[model samples]
Each structure stands twice: as structure tokens, then as C-alpha cells.
Target: MKKLLLAMGLSTFSMAASAAMVDFNTADADGNGAVTMEEAAAALPEVSPDAVAAADSNGDGVLTVAEYEALASQ
Candidate 1:
């Protein structure tokens, strides 16, 4: 039971750590909560242009929450 509890606690801790929030106010290179291709590039310049373009969901020329989540995953 102790080992099971420890494992559960560790799992929860790891999930919380990995689920850290991404701050758009700071991460928004274009001063927009939504990130444009250019802005996303500035946030993570190492990422390929194709990757940035792909991140622009809704086809609004900006990264939506889904896109930001995708970036966070990377």
C-alpha cells in the first residue's frame, strides 16, 4: 500500500510539473495572446518555419490555444 501511494503521488507530481502553464502575455512575441507565425518563431526560433505555420490553427494566421498547447508539448 505504501508503494502504491508513493507511485500515485509521484505520478501526480510529474503530471503537474509537465503541465506548467505557458504565459501568453510574456510568450506572445507579437503582443497578442494568439501567436502569429512570426511571433511563434520569435518565441522558439529554433523551430522550423513549417512547424510554425503548422501551429497556426483556425487558419487565422495565428496560433490558437490548441497551437500553443502543441508548442508546449514540444
Candidate 2:
């Protein structure tokens, strides 16, 4: 019973962490389905442009939802 309680607690914590993710639409100011460096800055001032560049997995100078989620998850 104690082990089951511990597992439930861990799952709840994981869900809470995932729920705290940054909003992709708010970051994508242009509504273009991707976030440019400028938009990312506006949404996450602490995040550097270099970080955004690194998150641009497709070399498109922008971050897709998947890319942004990957960065935020880190």
C-alpha cells in the first residue's frame, strides 16, 4: 500500500510539471504555427536567442510546437 501511494504521488508530480509548460500560442505571436526568436523572447525573457536557435530543429530559424516543448521540457 505504501508503494502504491508513492507511485501515485510521483505520477501527480509528473502531471503537475507537464501542466506548467509554456503556452505555445502565446509564444507564437504571429499565429504562424511557429515561434521566431523575437516571439520566444517576448514569451520567455530569460531564454536567450541562442537557446531558441538551438531549439530550431529544422534549421528554419523558428521553433515548432515540438521544438518549443522540447526546450521547455529541459
Q: TM-scores across all candidates?
A: 0.57, 0.67
* lDDT score for candidate 2 against the true structure: 0.72
lDDT of 1: 0.61
Question: Candidate 2, residues 1-74: lDDT per residue as tens digits?
Answer: 85465446545655665432557875676689988888776666557778878989899888888998887776
lDDT of 1 by residue, 1-74 (tens): 85465446545654666422433443464465787776565445456888777767667788876777787577
The residue ranges of model 2 lying beyond 4 angstroms of the native Cα positions read 1-20
Best by lDDT: 2
* TM-score attained by model 1: 0.57
Pairs in steric clash, model 1? none
Say which candidate scores most in TM-score.
Answer: 2
